[model samples]
Target: MDDNRTDKVLLYKGVKTMIFAVLTLFMGPIILSMALSQPENKLYIPLLVVGLLICAFAVFLIFKGIRLIMNSMFKK
Candidate 1:
């Protein structure tokens, strides 16, 4: 309804969208590398798990931001 909410929506969609998307995207490489490597490599399990978890969390954040933007758009 005002400039403050407009600014919030802009920041939400512009900054947060890119940040979360990039974080989630990078997780794929980490997960893939672990899967392709020897099973016994010490870091594989933890890295793979943590990477997937972070990816999931980032994706959730991205979705939440998208919902915020969408709701804001429809309200206008």
Candidate 2:
């Protein structure tokens, strides 16, 4: 196997993770806002919970992506 292949793979994985993280982070708030814009009170709690979960997962993704990127860069 070529030495650079692993580096490329890691880089690609990190980039994909970052992209997904950004989407998750932004979409969560946007969705929550849209949901709250409605006058109906029935779905508030559920939407809030789901939004928070999305945000939390986004954070985890962000951290994992950063870690993967750093590992790739420092790998010998």
Q: Ten-residue segment with the worst summed lDDT in candidate 2?
A: 1-10
Q: How accurate is candidate 2 locally (lDDT)?
A: 0.86
lDDT of 1: 0.69
- After superposing candidate 1 on the true structure, give the runs of residues whose Cα lies further than 4 Å from its correct spot: 1-15
Distance from true position, residue 29, model 2, in Å?
A: 0.8
Top-TM-score structure, candidate number: 2
Q: In model 2, which runs have C-alpha deviations exceeding 4 angstroms?
A: 1-6, 38-40
Can you write out model 1's per-residue Cα lDDT over 1-76, one digit (the tens) per residue?
4453454656567567767678777876668677558678887777777767777877777777776676655554
Query: Top lDDT: which candidate number?
Result: 2
**Against the correct fold, how does model 2 do in TM-score?**
0.81
Query: Against the hidden reference, what TM-scores do the models get?
Result: 0.59, 0.81
lDDT of 2 by residue, 1-76 (tens): 6564447789889999999999999989976896778748888778878888898999999999998887787786
